[model samples]
Target: MKYFFAIIYIITTVAINAQETHKRTLKLMGSRFDITVVANNKTEADTYIDIAVTEISRIEKLISSWDENSQTSKINRNAGIKAVHVDKELFDLIERAIQISKLTDGAFDISYASMDRIWKFDGSVTKMPTPENIKASVAKVGYQHIILDKEKQTVFLKIKGMKIGFGAIGKGYAADKAKQLLKQKGVQAGIINASGDMNTWGTQTNGDQWKVGITNPMNKNNVFALLPISERAVVTSGNYEKYIMINGKRYSHIIDPRTGYPSSGIVSVSVFAPSAELADALATSVFVMGKDVGLNFINQLKGIECIIVDEKGKIVHSTNIDIQDKLKNE
Candidate 1:
């Protein structure tokens, strides 16, 4: 459940049109959020951005596990005790997360929060964890144990120490919710960038599609491609920013919840889909699945494309996406 930095950079220029693009940067869900909206004037744009901020804050309060008063916390506190009734929105979100867990065959699980922090990326440990300890770390981290009742609107963890958190998908869900609210309020175009969990609708003020620059995992300062996106979401999960070198091999901070060990081989994964929530989850899933299996998994899904950078810095993409044609070499 470690959150990575934003690897997708927004490519923007000064707006020359009457309808200007307004942007505001702030902290939401314990991460950075960049909200941009196209409006007739600064006042209107600010109003729209404020609305997005409010919506994101509301979502954080509902889903944040760190908040003791949050419904998510209540659910965790009641693990193996009783089924805790939750709001319909949270119920649906958890339900969707469970479906994604099944789709990835448990590669993407919200119950990853139950995992013990045995592997440290802070360079405090000079050696890898014991195999037995590593195995035990994930004993309580199984999505299958999360029982949900639709009719009762309740969520229950079958194990006593089991817990669930949304560090991976919460920001994306917030971005999607904010975008939906802004669009319903008559905002024609906007981009909600929750760290790297970005969602866009409509186009730029000049009618061109919004561009996103994909960072080269080998060179964090370098951008390799610029992809034009409209009415879509793109999320990039990279291990370049947070990792440790052990026995001359780099270990990513993104651990595979099933194995209880940090993921290896793949350095970065970018996923583009219809919603930021799905893209964010799949981005992490691809990292856990490694390059070959991850690429194959993404290729099988329609309307979902992925770009992966392996440990050797080799770039591979899904069938529907051709980054070579769009490479900027920047």
Candidate 2:
């Protein structure tokens, strides 16, 4: 009888240990935040995600120019006249943005915000803009005009009234930073899914990798592909966010810095890269680059891949996409 009781106790201990798991999810930074940490104890993982949320929120404030008193707005207000020193994280992100602009030949410009909102996404814009309007809009859209004084750690928009904002890459950078914080906190496996911009690491409970679904452009209710992912980031950009109708044609909110016009041709573009920052910037660049240019640009990029859907509803994927066989779409 004693031996039988001891065996039952041993089995109970094993079952309890097997049931151990941890996950945390919340609304933060105007987006969804999800965290999964695999450990023998749930308390430790929960504590780590809490710490990560606080750190990421601090960064959002520093870089969010939309906030009335953010550090970036203060810098934009001062412009070239005075340099406002920022924390290293903000400074580094801006610096990297400039590099991406140069690499993509201004396709991924941060200074594109300097252009006025004459190209409204509302239904009121019934016709295309005149040549004069197009020319004037791009006058301040040059990426080269974004001035960064490395010595002083200040970001200056050289053109007066020009602005710099991270509407494109902010979420991705935040996700990347948050993932780093989690890894530093000893999280062995997890995902930080910021909206649709997700950064994943390690494997699932069954030893399989994270499976990410690519939404079908033609049918929002269906997924066209199920890609297995691990230790990577994916971000999607599309006209679904905002648009306008002109001459019975839909124009996306994304503008081309070169043409001073809202972009079209591609309905959506999702990029996968080693870090969320790259995925963020690439998604925006690909949207502005249009279908052909965007596809070529992604192909040339190392440590990166993409899934691009054209306005005609045709899907194009990077040569390297690793989709699973179990659920191949028709």
Candidate 3:
């Protein structure tokens, strides 16, 4: 009887320790990164986290247009002058981004870097830009104009000032790459949250799926719904944080590359997909596409889902995603 009770105590203690979750927070890629992993020891978790950080930084250097020495910056600097040769990694990433632009009908464009910032969402703007000004703003912003020479492995912007930047999808790409690297290193489960672009694999220590909450755009502190996810990516793009009110109307910071106007009618769009890169771009596209068109587009995709909150504070979800109210359960 003494030996039996001792065995039970050891089993319980081991289980408790195995369920421990270790987390590390840092700033990377101009965003707050919250990395979490379930591990048996602190040393193991720290090692995996460091690997993720290094991978993210490497990707940022490769794709950052702001960095004068980055490959992307070189491509932009030579716009209309010559085709800039680049590595296969950047070439493939740009190809994929262009594909997404076609799918979204230019709603998701990387050439937005060339857009004239004539429309300001700041509180100072009391009037809208004229039609001619709006049209001219996007004259240099078109995905079709971004030429990719597959045979020569070069990227060329047809217009002299035309440029491509990965602001919309860069963080998510970093998250995906970090997750893949950690998994390759034999890390069972972890989450890479770049700002709000979160990608997770494996389960929690308690053997349950990770729960992600969709923040209520109206009440920033409260979550409207909770989503259960495993080996999936969820990205939320909301304009609530950066917007300006003018004459009783609210304008989001996200401007449509097609139109020089700030995206309106939608407060937030959260996307879940197999890859964080896709989810991130889609979230921004949905915000520009508005609720009805965005939901329709998401519903057609096999493994993609979306949740949109409109300006009226109404919560909407794509056909496949059914959100659970955690507050109601509580």
The candidate that wins on TM-score is 1
Best by lDDT: 1
Q: Give the count of colliding residue pairs in each prediction.
A: 0, 0, 0
In angstroms, what RMSD does candidate 2 have relative to the true structure?
Answer: 9.9
lDDT scores in order: 0.90, 0.73, 0.82
Residue range with the least summed lDDT across 10 consecutive positions in model 1: 321-330
* Model 2 lDDT per residue over 1-330, tens place: 000000000000112344344667787777766666666676776687787788779878988878878988887787657667877778888899989989888878877767777787667778888989998987877778777788888777777777787877777788888888888877777777776677888766556666777765555766777777789988776675467777767677888777888877777777889998888888888888888888888888887999887776787887766656443332
Pairs with steric clashes in candidate 2:
none
For model 2, the local distance difference test gives 0.73
Q: Compute the lDDT of residue 324 as modeled in candidate 1.
A: 37
Tell me the spans in candidate 1 whose CA falls farther than 4 Å from its real position.
Answer: 13-15, 322-330
Estimate the lDDT of model 1: 0.90
Per-candidate alpha-carbon RMSD to the true structure: 1.5, 9.9, 8.9
